[model samples]
Target: MAPPGDSDSSGKKSVVVTALDGVINVNALFTIAIFVGLSLASPGQRSLNSKESCQPGILTVKQLVIFEVLSFSFFLFSSLVAQAIKLSLNLLSSEELAHGFSVVVNEKILKAGMLMTAISSVMGCLFLMISMLNVIEIKTGMLFCGAKSTIISVTFLIVLVVSGLLVYISAAWYAFTHARVHFHRQRTGL
Candidate 1:
């Protein structure tokens, strides 16, 4: 059997699936980049440095940051796994092993990976939003110094929150819809 996109008559792969894969790829790449950026910009254990020197809620900020990092780490892992599965599927396009046990197994694995990725992405988004809120609280509670910096930081946090939400929704919707479409096609040979 030909791969999903190889022949139009096969109808094995819907456009939604293809578009979902593309969106997943883009979001996965962006998430990896965010992780790298966060790692590089991490302030380390500075929050623990002398309570007198730190803000009142510095401890909470530290905890939120840790939580955000962990959630994003899980999201990154899931996204990578999903992307790797998609890559493997693409690599096998030229092979003649399309209608075997392996094909069905791989398809199932891909769907599972996508589902996990969607879940993880949503969790990451929630964690990140909490982290952003913590940052906002910390900023607002600070003295009247660095107002410009606070504004800039708040703007950046809002942007991140909005973008993360968009990614989460898109990823989840794509994963679920693609899975349903795949199931329907398989059942009815559409």
Candidate 2:
């Protein structure tokens, strides 16, 4: 993978690189951008005295709240999925099934995990877009509400689903191939 912020020769920016490149250190950037925004716009803080004291701009406050909530939710969900994947992979590696059966099981679990992750990512992106639309000007909101954004969102969702299915198929194929090899070895006592 390219280092964060390093452009490839083709001049296309890698998502990994862009995501990693912080305007400041990662921790500080997230704190300032995410946590603070959440605290400021949290529904719990929307009281008479608190609202009077803060008096944040309506659109800005709404936008901040939307982004903060969506980001935090995504982070939590992703972490849980990652932990589950790790645990599943460990178990699959250690378990004893028929050689072919074991491979098939592991591959299916991996593919399922990947599909879950892709689904989570797509949902997160869709939520973010909806939140943005909620806070934008009328004209801007109208534009996004048009077929363009709808088409783009649908396209991305389709891609995510298809890619996930491909991963699953590949994993199953690997497992089947390995099992065949193991069966042959066992039969030959090699």
Candidate 3:
């Protein structure tokens, strides 16, 4: 059995691992959404080009493909790293393997993997957002103005997406700041 301090540390590490596992699941859903977006855009793009690659709307389709592919790549990479971290943690947690792995090494690996996965997940969302805008543009019209209705609808969607992103960022900022402050106070016995 671990001492009190070690128990606390292990508990915190377990919490982090659980959080990362949840993130991997969420990212998987986003990965599926990426494919869905591609399928939605594919019909229109195929009708437009299908051959003459130099077509006008084809370029937009290409850009959409680029963004979607990027989103998929980033999310996939994050998932891969999360899996690797889980594997490493599991291996190190075993009594036989635990002797060879230092706590510091495990901590460093967890922190690095968590940081990379977080960054990649955020980037993937950004790319997915951009691809979504492209989908809106493709379905609605060219140069963002097929009609007044299309313009208004796209505007509304953009506002919602941007607002959602702001909310997410704000929440993350608040959560991290409060958590750190609480930890500091606890450590200082304040």
Using lDDT as the measure, the top candidate is 3
Q: Model 1: runs farther than 4 Å from truth? A: 1-6, 9-54, 95-107, 142-190
Q: Sorted on lDDT, highest at the top, how do the candidates line up?
A: 3, 1, 2
- For candidate 1, the per-residue lDDT at 163 reads 87
Mark the regions of model 2 whose C-alpha exceeds 4 Å error after superposition. 1-33, 39-56, 95-106, 125-190
Deviation from native of the Cα of residue 48 in model 3, angstroms: 14
Candidate 2, residue 34: Cα displacement in angstroms equals: 2.4
Assess the local accuracy of residue 78 in candidate 2 as a C-alpha lDDT between 0 and 100: 46
Global local distance difference test of model 3: 0.67
Off by over 4 Å in 3: 43-56, 95-102, 106-108, 146-149, 167-190
Write the residue-wise lDDT of candidate 1 on 1-190 in tens digits.
Answer: 3335345423444453465476566556656644543443334323222344444344655655576676667667666766675565554442444434233324566667767766676676666655555554454433233345556766787788788678768867765675443312121121
Residues forming the 10-long window of minimal summed lDDT in candidate 1: 181-190
**lDDT (10s digit) by residue, model 3, range 89-178:** 556555564443444434445566766887788889889888887776666555333456446767787788678777866765564445
Per-candidate TM equals 0.54, 0.37, 0.71
Q: Weakest 10 consecutive residues, lDDT, candidate 3? A: 181-190
Model 1 alpha-carbon miss at residue 81, Å: 1.9
Q: What is the alpha-carbon lDDT for the whole of candidate 1? A: 0.54
In model 2, pairs of residues that clash are none
Candidate 2 Cα lDDT to native? 0.42
Error of 2 at 62 (Å): 3.0
Rank candidates, TM-score, best first: 3, 1, 2
